[model samples]
Target: MYAAVTLFVFMCLTATSHADHHHHPCHSPNMTGFMSVMTLKGEVRAHGAFTYDSMGKKLRFRSNESHPVNTSIGLDVLMFFEEGVFYEIDSKNQSCEKKALQCSIHPMDIPDDAKFHCAMNLGNPSIEGEGFKANVWTGDIPGKKGVYSMSVTMGCLPVSTIYFMDSTTILFSILDIENEIKDPDLLVVPSFCQGQPLEETPEGTVNTFYNEFI
Candidate 1:
């Protein structure tokens, strides 16, 4: 009976660990609209306990590789402008051809309720998964170039955004109060995206390819 009980407990623990591993949300383009690219410089302070992921050969976020100093470190983040489009990447990473891979524009499919303006206010956000949630807030992030504030609730997680600058340059700052530091190394640039001159595809559209470096 003792041995049986021990086996049962071990099984339960394994099950729980497996369940926790599957919490990452799906990241794909769902919303559509014009795309814009820019670089952001700032300091990252882990307000709470956070862990960075360094696995995944592609799309890896390797925050654990180097222990990020608690002090202010110069940061360059790649920003993609499109409703519901968010990706964090090292903006200083360059391509072999000497092109700045700091950021890229990924076009999205527009939603029926999509609106183009300076502000959005969405209440009662929903959660998509572990470390993933859907949120809405209003701001002049794409146009007008003004400071706007927004709050989003994804799966009960509250996220806030502040639009600090918009003009010849656009800037949006995001703070995840309850952000779980899952591997920040998950989003490393693929080698194919590293360096290449402009080229046309068979579809007559221009796109860049990145190699798997993670």
Candidate 2:
């Protein structure tokens, strides 16, 4: 689960450094509302909704992911992002954990085979699809060198509609849209799960979790 989410998030967006924020299509100036999004990557498909404010300080999401590794398992995730912290909800234990997803990378530490990947970028000026005109950007991800692309519509809402790793096409799209989110409280972790954060999920636990849910 950790590897799945981190791989999706960190490798996304334009090659432009994070410092050039205004140009990032994913960072819509109007992303501050509510809607449900569905994403399909590789063999995993996830559906969820989010509510956020304009400041980008708070975002709450609830989604279910496809079972890729084991057909018998299902994964439903509830997460909140604030400042630089990522909080994942463990409903079975009724806890909001902040440490389970932390990871670091050192380019020098990676083996040479892993370093052969080339960076991907927006192919050209974004193209539009179907009913309306939306910006489309394409880039490639390192997993077998897949080419990925996304589209953002009105209010700056975006989804990764097509991602091809090796020879497979992974898709992400918005299932539905609505204005005005009723529950503002969704932006914060539930009180029952608040306090000191839980420890990082151990590698063994991660393996077990994925074994059950992937």
Candidate 3:
């Protein structure tokens, strides 16, 4: 159980870095890594700004039609795994509705620390990507339940992504990864999830929107 929660938290939260503030790798592990796979559910705020091309003509702005990105809001995410299988919830809204559904674990990347465990110096490393440089700060998650926190550098980017048909058509993206940690008590499986481990996907999908806008 411990191992499962640990993996779940690290895996799901790690992938979120591309969305929130850009997180650079930490030079050292600040908190003791969890030995269990945890189920994490919490809120994160996403903020972004964009300008439509005038195309030499003024486009009238409509309040209803305009899908202005959230200046800041929280998100609820879940992490669960067992029997070598894993599951995650990538809800679009804090309310956890289907219509607001974002992405699932259909295909995601769980970075291989052994493969890319680049040691970062003090503070947070500056990871330069597209239009942002993720500033990652490694530390422990708040509360005594044993959690880790990695604050990504928001710099200038969207808070979350709005998915499209081809996965590349992202309407919004996460600005940074605020918090990540393990919770041994989150054992009950959510009815909306199915546990089945799948191959890891590329990180391009997570960063696609950031590259396009930033």
Candidate with best lDDT? 2
Instruction: Flag clash pairs in model 2.
Output: 69-214, 70-214
TM-score of each: 0.21, 0.49, 0.21
lDDT of 1 by residue, 183-204 (tens): 4442334354544342322443
lDDT of 3 by residue, 69-97 (tens): 24222222232211222223333321222
RMSD of 1: 19.0
Candidate 2 lDDT tens digits, 69-149:
333222333333233345556667776556442221101012112212122333343554323434444444432356545
Assess candidate 1 and give its lDDT: 0.27
Per-residue lDDT for 113 in model 2?
Answer: 24
Against the true structure, whose TM-score is highest?
A: 2
lDDT of each: 0.27, 0.40, 0.25
Question: Model 2: how far is 74 from its true place, Å?
Answer: 7.3
Candidate 3 lDDT at 132 equals 28
